[model samples]
Target: MEAATKPKLRVATTSLAGCFGCHMSFLDIDERLFDLVKLVEFDRSPLTDIKHCGPCDIGIIEGGLCNAENVHVLREFRANCKTLIAIGACAVNGGLPAQRNHLSLASILEEVYHAQHGLVDGFIPNDPELPLPLDKVHPIHEVVKVDYFIPGCPPSGDAIWKVLTDLLAGREPELGHGLIHYD
Candidate 1:
């Protein structure tokens, strides 16, 4: 009789309010992705192109919260994921999107829509179809419990791989000095 193989772990990922740089870095794993697939299956990620997240063993989220939609997604993702990792500076601290926090939303909207040189009928959008913007951007931790954080503008593929491997082995993830980076 053939030995039964263990089921692969299910992992999902999403981006909320920043550039998709972190996901780009994840792609830096390159051909190692083939190896990764042997141990895990992607769920609700760009890899799978699945819109809704089902229950998952791990969820990797990048970017910060900037709107009601983002909050809803984060909460739903948290509920569906057994382990959630917040990756990149944006997910860790609100990153560049949080720069808008220094200014009032009204003023920013006014300047962009009403005061700009464009001569058309400029007004703030009030359509219910639009996701409501938040007063300030927020890190994922502010709105949901996060199991782990990978700190970097976009953490290198090696760092991400290390953390993932450690978790898969049921060990605490530890980054060496060489793997840790801010750029």
Candidate 2:
């Protein structure tokens, strides 16, 4: 009889508010992705085009919460995945999106839609189809329990690879000085 092979781990990834730089960095894993594929299966990631996340072994999320939709998705993701990792500065501390924290949402919306010189009768969008905006942007931790955090504006591909590899090997991820970077 042939020996049964171990089931591959299921990994999912998502982005919330900030720019998609972190996902770009993840793609920078480049050729090594082939090796990664052997050990894990992608779930609800952009790479898979799967809209809804199923049960997953690990969920990697980037960006901060900016709207009601973001919170809903993050909560759902947290419920579906056993281990959750918050990646990039936005996920860790709200990053560039949290810059609006100092300003009122109403003022910001007015400045963007009403005061801009583009149109004659611009107004803030109030359509129910749109996700309701939050008064302040918030990090993932503020909304859900996060297991691990990979810091950096968008953590380098090498750092991501290290963390994933360590987790896969059942070892605690350790970012040495060389692997930990902000830029």
Candidate 3:
């Protein structure tokens, strides 16, 4: 009997408690991205209208979970995706958002818009729909078992391309360490 042909890999990417800059960086791959599309298919991502996790082989998460919603999304992705990659410093180490975590979320909000800025007329509603306070902006590994991480303030398009290529080729995606990461 012949072995079944491996399915073309499906991919999904999402951002959590981040600026969505890394997702833009991924699109900045441009024409080079065309090469990757041939091998893999994109599913649920902020870039796509698709809102829920479908069948996916790889999940590329670009930010850290800073709230209850983020945690829910991460867990959903983890449950669905075969391999999970944490992309960018925010996802890898919480990035700049971690800085604000020094103070309570309410305090930070008040300091920024109410006290110092003097927006007393404005109300800061701590609604359930709003993101919950983060104890700290932790890396993806802190929340879940991430299969891989590409750590950078924002990883370059070339680096993202290389990671995909290496993984597709069935080799360890050597996205460098320290300086030339994954080169």
Taking all chains together, each candidate's TM-score versus the true structure is 0.93, 0.95, 0.88
Residue lDDT tens for model 2, 60-83: 999999999999989989999999
**Model 1 lDDT, residue 148, Cα:** 96
Write down the RMSD of all candidates, one decimal each.
Answer: 2.2, 2.1, 3.5
Q: Against the hidden true structure, what lDDT does model 3 obtain?
A: 0.80
The window of 10 residues in a row where model 1 has the poorest summed lDDT is 1-10
Q: What lDDT tens digits, residue by residue, belong to model 1 across residues 72-156?
A: 9899899999999999989999988899999999998899888889847999998999999999999999999999999898999
Q: lDDT of each model, Cα atoms only?
A: 0.91, 0.92, 0.80
Error of 2 at 163 (Å): 0.3
Superior candidate under lDDT, 1 versus 2: 2
Q: Model 2 segments beyond 4 Å from truth?
A: 1-4
Candidate rank order under TM-score: 2, 1, 3
Residues 1-183, candidate 3: write the lDDT tens digits: 111255568999999877887888788799977777767778998767999888688999988878788888898999999999999888888888888767777787677767775575766667777777566677778878999888776888777878888888888988565424421
Q: Find the candidate with the highest lDDT and give its number.
A: 2
Q: Candidate 3 versus the native: TM-score?
A: 0.88
List pairs with backbone clashes in candidate 2.
none
